[model samples]
Target: MITINNEPTAYTPIFLGTTQHSLRLSLEILIMVGMKLNDEIIETYNVSVSAIELGQLPDIGSEIAIDEITGSELSGFKAKLKQSDAKIQNTASTELEKLVDLKNVGRYQLLKGQKNMTQELNVPTLTNDNLILMRQMLGVTQKELSVTMGINEKTIRRIENKEQGISERFVNKLLAVYPELAQIIEVQFDWVSLTFPDLTSKQVIDDVLRLQDNLFLERPTSQNFYTREMAFAGEKNIYIQDFAPFKNPETQAIEQKFGTTLYLTGKGTRLFEKALLEQSMNWRNFFEKARQYRGHLTRLDIAINDKWGLLNMNDLVKAVQEKRFWSKSKSYAVHGN
Candidate 1:
């Protein structure tokens, strides 16, 4: 029995050594024992208490103490709990690493496949704005257009809004349904025109050649010179006076062909003279050379010479300067000069 504040209570011995006793009293007795032990140490005493005896005492302390064996067991249990917690944390970390590796591998494979597909198939994509514009231009509602194109209306709407990507088959279907609309939605090229004045005969010829090439013309010919029959149509008794006197038969034939008959009008004469002066060539000298070449020249020879000679040079220069020579409405075969 132990006295707690002068009341008797049962007690239990925690450790019993030879000639020694260690007691762990109940909380109520522990408090009273603490007060008594505070003043003096006591001799060894045997004590015992049953569980039923402990129930009769009033509850006083928050904590209960087990025997020494149980206390030692609790410490070992806490150590095992820490080890288990560590093992669980390590397992979670390993699983996380594996998951990350798998995700990265999947992403790499997907990217590789996409690259190969892009190279294998030459597919073109259209933007949302272009898709919408094309649909509007074709005057088709989403549902009707989708039905005609053999695609889902929701897919069409998604493509138009850029919410979803379009497939090559869908693009082809749209093109087939609205051929003109495809052209309207395509990227366009801009054309620019340039103007110049006072270009030389050579320059005009070069420009015309360039234009012909651009327009995809096969064969281009100048309209300056004419053939024998073409030059002297109504003339009669065309006889050459002296072959040596004229440098070219073509020139001679042309002179004989015209022979002062093809009189130039006042306006035509002024235009021709202006053209020659602008080209910085002597018109008189040109005619003299033509007369010299005309002696025994063939029609083709004369035509070629005249073109390369002064007439074309002067005319081309004038046409560029005045804008009057090459009008579409003006005919090349005038009766006069």
Candidate 2:
């Protein structure tokens, strides 16, 4: 049933197919029709929602012949037209409400999905000091980090300055913005590969050993083909190759293309954990040196083994399927059950 001037109007064939599934699509059609009818109806009349709500419909006022609207027939025609107009208004209002509700639902779902994605990714006893350190290591100012992390600059400042204690919500938001931080959160590196186009192997080795007064690692040992290799106790090792392998034309061409002149690689996590644990290796200084030497970072890997089972891949997939998340990937695929 539909209301018309406080009276109920039943569904009829005349109103069938008048409503559209998509209110926005219907609005587009109405706009197009209004544009086309501009010449015919422009400046002739104006109607608005307020007018409709106020029941301030325009007067018919001698527009129709007196004979055409006479007695009971005229009254019936007037009632029917009023009923149709009221039904249209009600339908439009309902559809508009639906559109607003849909928008709110989408917003809620997206936030919920994001929460689910980061709820378990705790930063393991995060503190104001570490937060400051992370920001400094990333080489971003507080304002720049706030913009990138989607957090307020004032909040970041408060947290870093010890005015506010670190909260789980803040850490979750931080990790959501920078999941890579999990790997390097504690200033640890799992694997690092650097190529120096200008510096010799000896120069690179000397710089590494001199970083912390050679207190961590033993002296370098000669390796087959490779110039030198240094190792801390355990499985951590740094391998250096003074020259690129140009065994064949193909290898030489590959080296030329990639520019692997003097390759240096530090592999395994124990190297940092044992050897450089107490060392103050300024990453900014290292980056500046690399830039000075025109070195290339061929490979760098960061990963966190979720031994505590913090990550949920299933929820991530669900978020993607529900279109409740944003991504840079052109496309995503779901394999297996």
TM-score of each: 0.22, 0.28
Tens digits of lDDT, candidate 1, 218-326: 1222323322211100111111111111245656552222211121222222222222333333433434433442322122100111211213455765665565654
Alpha carbon lDDT of each predicted model:
0.30, 0.40
**Pick by lDDT: which candidate is best?**
2
Which 10 residues in a row give candidate 2 its minimum summed lDDT? 29-38
Cα distance off (Å), candidate 1, residue 13: 99
**Model 1 CA RMSD to the hidden true structure, in angstroms:** 51.9
| Candidate 1 Cα misplacement greater than 4 A, ranges | 1-125, 181-337
For model 2, state the Cα shift of residue 205 in Å: 0.9
**Model 2's lDDT to the true fold?**
0.40
